[model samples]
Target: MEKNAPCTTVCPTKALKQDEVTRVVTHSTDLCIGCWACSMVCNYGVIGRQKEARVAVKCDLCPGREIPACVEACPTNALVFLEVKKLSGVKRTEAALKLARGMQGKAL
Candidate 1:
């Protein structure tokens, strides 16, 4: 949820997405499957299908950490990270929609 993730809205399963062309990272939640496919393919280890969410998830640019472990480990700087201004209209819309969906209650 960096700021401008396009794939978050586009994903049919609501699984994963990069913030934008520039972010070059991904975000995941409890829907991961632990497939390890994302970790295997991406040069930056930007993907991981964990068991919690039963789906794939990735980088998500560690905000609190002073430095990312992956970035420090990278030999070629393939995963340069950046932060964006929170002036996100699309993000607000999507979050609003998600919140509304939550109010509907969980599926039985």
Candidate 2:
């Protein structure tokens, strides 16, 4: 999750908080007052509204589940669940591979 997303910061009821261990942003529906403050400030547009309940909704990473249902149900594997450090390592490896390929047969 974003280190300091506006949605988390603007939540008046403190319903949204980031898990220090998982780094995942969690939402407490009980604490939510449907103020829409979090939704308004969400830059990623991930926050949604429950019209009937008047409560804001968002992916909470399926607490207590190994993988979120959304990620598991994705047909094309477009949605992936990875830890922050693992994702960073994957990106770094990709960059290194690309750089190595580009430097092939090209001397300093």
Assess each prediction's global lDDT (C-alpha) against the native: 0.56, 0.85
Q: Quick one: best TM-score, which candidate?
A: 2
Candidate 1: global Cα-lDDT? 0.56
Residue 70 lDDT, candidate 1, scale 0-100: 85
Each model's TM-score?
Answer: 0.34, 0.65
lDDT of 1 by residue, 1-108 (tens): 345444454555455655455554455555444555545555434455556656666655566776787877899977544443343555687899999888897665
For model 2, what is the alpha-carbon lDDT of residue 63? 80
lDDT value, candidate 2, whole model: 0.85
lDDT of 2 by residue, 1-108 (tens): 566777778898899987776667778899999998988888667789998898889897788899999999999998888866788899899999999999999989
Model 1, residue 103: C-alpha shift (Å): 64
Candidate 2 Cα outliers beyond 4 Å, as residue runs: 82-108
For residue 64, model 2's alpha carbon misses the true position, in angstroms, by: 3.6
TM-score of 1: 0.34
